[model samples]
Target: MNANMRAAAPTEVLRYTAFSADPDGGNPAGVVLDASALDDAARLAVAAEVGYSETAFLTPAPQGTEGAPEGRAFTTRYFSPLAEVAFCGHATIATAVALGERIGPGELLFLTPAGPIPVTVVGGDGESGPRATLSSVEPHSEPVEDKDLTEALAALGWARGDLDPEIPPRIAFGGNDHLVLAVTSRERLGALDYDFERLKELMLRLGLTTLQLVWRESAGVFHVRDPFPVGGVREDPATGAAAAAFGGYARELGIVPEESRFTLHQGEDMGRPGELTVDLRAGDPRVHVSGTAARIG
Candidate 1:
């Protein structure tokens, strides 16, 4: 792996979690610290080899000083195994913690393709180690088209009667756009079965990043499972992108307090459990998603 990453053409994958401390928890991501040297094909190849849901690529800031820039900032781009993604929150968290390891815990300013994302890394060493929290870009939500909503439900093998009317469907954007669909029951959320190719096709046509399937467990808590066929994944355990989108969706619909902190549990059915904390500011539209990520290996 070192040879692959440092042999004139450097591209190595460093594993880290996105939303939890335990390696078994959180969303896993691959990080390539020096992607500045690689071309698009090389970078994509490296990501495909690394095999995480997504990988973060770091390049010299288009406009900034070298050697970690001001406030540990750098330009970043994210890519899945198959294609490039505009932004990825889980990968942002993973890369922040990875940077923290090399430079010691502190704040990292990630100049993402979507926008500038600031991440703070705190805690680390032996039994106790570093964890990261990322504040997302400004979030916003819009009403879901009735016809589109019905199509989405049919795609997921769900019924209109099974939806939570209060949360109202919406297409929300935090970093990337996500379709927020709230199921009336946890059982409906858990019994996920969809034609992968069909969903992928539909998502591509709609320019969607993922499908946020959720069930509100309480006023300030929710359970989520994301169908990411768009990214060639069946289900995502913990999705920081969707969490941010969901936060915006909830607030836009007056379902939760304007400034509130909430919990999201995902991946229980798949058995790789993860917990994500979503924080909304009183006047800010950007939702902050917090979690601790450990090395997958």
Candidate 2:
């Protein structure tokens, strides 16, 4: 029975959520451990097989099959039901936790299209599943021009006055580019009426991946909503990558204190609430977004 035991389950596919514990609480993702066995079409079929928005396909780990405790990591690729993305934060989180369950949780390194990301699996507890936090690659942000800002505002049907003076407009990047627009009023953030097609077109034209609409509730806390027209979704519930990017943007532009740790509350308006915590170090460029996930049945 021990010799007959296979390392991987027959299904080879696992489902988990990012940023929350409840099954219905967070972003769902599909994970495939040994996608090397499947061709592109087969892998894609497997992704569509799971029917999640995005699924992660992993390449065979490395020359050294470095076992658990310090768990094995591999090159990871993300694909939506439609197409591939440079990266997906939620899927990365889900995949990390899945691997942790098998390898017994420690440091797992993922070589992503964007770069190498390090994930630490903090092992499971009595009733709780394992938790993993991935530190993003060198994060950075740039100023969004006035002209482009106007167009973005137009696409979202949001006026300039709606923006918060403290947190100005900026384009941020962790693995993907997101235009961070801060709204002054919570009402404006809650009233998320936007031109879907128009925003999508604008995003494509500008090479933007998502629009990070944020309403700062306080110095250490914020309410965030992401408009992801490019991903073919109206919004992302909890965006770990975007939160990491925002941490960089805020720190660089003096929007927040030099070394500040903050919490972002998102998807409340959509009713699938999630929380993200971003920790910023004084000299380090890597942004860390931490959250726990649960299996979504």
Candidate 3:
């Protein structure tokens, strides 16, 4: 059998919601604990069947994949219903918490396409579930080209005047590229009606993972929405990757001070209502995102 199609039997896939203790809230991800025997095709098939925004597949370290040890480390890959993503923050958090439940919480390393991501999972108390914090790869943001920005705004059904003059448009990267567009009011952020296919086309052309639609509620609080047409999801309830990227953007823009921590409210409009915490250290460039997750099924 071709390696990509070789599979002995069906593997167990766990369902978990990331960034929320309540099973009905947060972003749901399908977790395959042992995918060593499955090939790319099989993984894709599994993700499609699960029908989550993203599904995480964990396999023993493959040749050329390095980090930690045999049992302590794994090569993790994320797949959406339609395609594979370089990294997925919510899925990573969910996977870590799931592993913590089985192996006892501590530190877990993932060898991902983006790079090695270090995740720390805290064991859950009886009442509340486990929480995981994942430190992103070094983050960076750059000015969005005027033409690209214009195209994005048009696709979002937004005009240049609709944006917050303070938070200029930028392309930010934590693990994946996200176009960060900050609006002047929460009303604007909540009223999200866009040209889906047009936005998807532009995102695919620019290699964007999601459009980070944001509104600043206060100095330390914000509301965020992610448009993830590229991933075959209209919107993600809670997006850890975009949160990290936005944290980097805010710090770089001096909108928030260094060594700052903030709360992000997401999925409110969709009724999922998940919360994510983002932290930045004085000197460290990488962003940290923390949230709690629970098993759904």
**lDDT winner among the candidates?**
3
Prediction 3 TM-score vs. true: 0.94
CA lDDT of each candidate? 0.83, 0.82, 0.92
Each candidate: RMSD to true structure? 3.4, 4.4, 3.1
Residue 255, model 3, lDDT: 89
Q: Write candidate 2's Cα lDDT for 60-104 as tens digits.
A: 556664442233769898876656778788888888888877777
The candidate that achieves the highest TM-score relative to the unseen native structure? 3
Candidates, ranked, TM-score? 3, 1, 2
Per-residue lDDT of model 3, residues 1-297, tens digit only: 776995568789999999999998999999999998888998999999999999999987655545574466888999999999999999999999999999988888888899889899997777768899999998889988999999999998898888998888899999999999999989999999888899999999999999999899899999999999998899999999999999998998898998999999999999898999999999898899999999996
- Per-candidate TM-score against the hidden true structure: 0.93, 0.90, 0.94
The collision pairs in model 2 are none
Model 2's alpha-carbon lDDT is 0.82
Tens-place lDDT per residue, model 1, 1-297, is 765575473557799877777888778899988887788898788787887778999976765444345657788998888899988988888888888889888878888878888788887656647777787888888877888887888788888999888877889999999998888998888889998887787789778999988899898788999988877678877888888888888888789899899999987887778888888889887888887778888
